[model samples]
Target: MTDAIADAKRAMRAELRERRHLLSDHARETAEAGIQAQLDALIAERDVRSMSCFLSTTTEPGTRKFVTDAVARGIRVLLPVTRNDGLLDWAVATTDGDISEGLFGLPEPVGELLGPIAVNDVDLLVIPAAAVDASGMRLGWGRGFFDKTLGSMERCPPVYAVVYDSEVVDEVPREVHDQRVTGVVTPTRTLTLAPTRR
Candidate 1:
């Protein structure tokens, strides 16, 4: 059963990733703008002082503008630095200028390393995902980095996954170790999920 679920999730990831890659630059920019607007509203509503977010890839929902703007607002922002063991280390991303390519071809900050547990210090957490179901189950990349990190948190703050609007679905293949998100932020809207059967 585990293997079948993994395989199904693998196929879903590929399809979602391919769809993201096919988005045009103009479409992505427009989506980013919409996402940024929703993000700003959420941040203010929640009074988020610090957050851990991912440095989005070109094909992913763009987060550069959001990160830059957050930094400018004096909101502390941390980006993940993938480690050799598949766990992630955190680092300050005070600005958008110091990012560089890191493990798994993802962008990361060059600031002082804050170790893995630094994620616990944030008031909010913004995770990257290929898709998220209406019940708040997130479908991340095959790697278990975010899953492990979230599982390790003692008092996890509100966690939100960033994805395109279409990626939000009614269901997603989930394993026992998979972590659930509190909400999902898309380019067009923010879905604050109500509790559902797990």
Candidate 2:
């Protein structure tokens, strides 16, 4: 990545993080509810029998409620476990699954680890992103875990990034390794971007 692109990404991520930190409690609650509804609707629309999702960090758009509800509905949900080698392992989500802080202090499942390939079986993927642009390019947090996962997949399912409504911007910095998502889910709406992957 060029220095200019890297610097741009850092600035964008910092600005977004600050915005999330400043969100009012009421705003957060409202956003969470909206996100849950949008996600539930997406699941139903896609007929997603199995899928992968991330446990939201406090400052990210909330997914815990959606995760719990999906498991309750008998959907096979897999939560990510960060691996030391810059890849992610998967774990089956349970309604009563234990959560513990993993690498980067992100919330992770405390269940039997399913290897990285476990994600290949999913019907869909909902991932975390600092921001996503109109053209579907996703700006992930500095780490490339999701990028690598998406890049390595032989046949990736539809991938969506969850962010606050404001984070869906006109454009964001992108690198060749940065993976684009099929759509984006925000507090107010879900948008399907033009598909760029084969």
Candidate 3:
């Protein structure tokens, strides 16, 4: 990627992070509720049995309740554990275990460690993102963990980046290593992108 593109992504991420941190508690709660409703429809429509999803941190669209509810509903949920190499490993999020803080200040599942390839078994994915564009390109935090994971898949299942509705924009700066998602899920709606060979 060119320096200009990299710089643009960094700038955008910083701006978005500030805006996300500024969201009021009430607004965040309302958005979380809306996201749960949308998730219900998505699960039914896709007949999602096993899937990978992230545990949301504060300043991101909340997914804690949804993760717990999904586990209760007997859907297998895999949450990522960041490895030392910046690759992600998977762990099952059970209903009763205490969550421990992992790298990058993200809360992680305290369960059996499933190797990296475990994510490939899921029927779908609900990943965290700062923003996603109309064409499915996702702008994530600088780290590139999800980008590496997605790119390594031989036949990746449908992947959706969860973001606020307003973060769905006309475009986001992209680079060769940046993997596009299958779609994006906002608090209000799920936006599907046309299938692309990449």
Candidates' C-alpha lDDT: 0.88, 0.94, 0.90
| Per-residue lDDT of model 3, residues 1-198, tens digit only | 899998999999999999999999998998898888888788889999999999889888988899999999999999999998989999998889678899988889888899999988788888999999989999999898999999898878888889999899999999989989988888999889747323
Q: How much does each candidate deviate from the true structure in C-alpha RMSD?
A: 2.1, 0.8, 1.2
Which residue pairs does candidate 1 place in steric collision?
none
Per-residue lDDT of model 2, residues 143-192, tens digit only: 99999999999998999999998999999999889889999999889999
Candidate 3 lands at a TM-score of: 0.97
Worst 10 residues of 3 by lDDT: 189-198
lDDT of 1 by residue, 78-161 (tens): 889999998899998886458789988898888789889988878888889989998889999988899999888888888889
Whose TM-score is greatest here? 2
- Show model 1 residue runs off by greater than 4 Å: 194-198
Better of 2 and 3 by TM-score: 2
Local lDDT at 150 for model 1: 88
Q: Model 2, residue 161: displacement in angstroms? A: 0.5
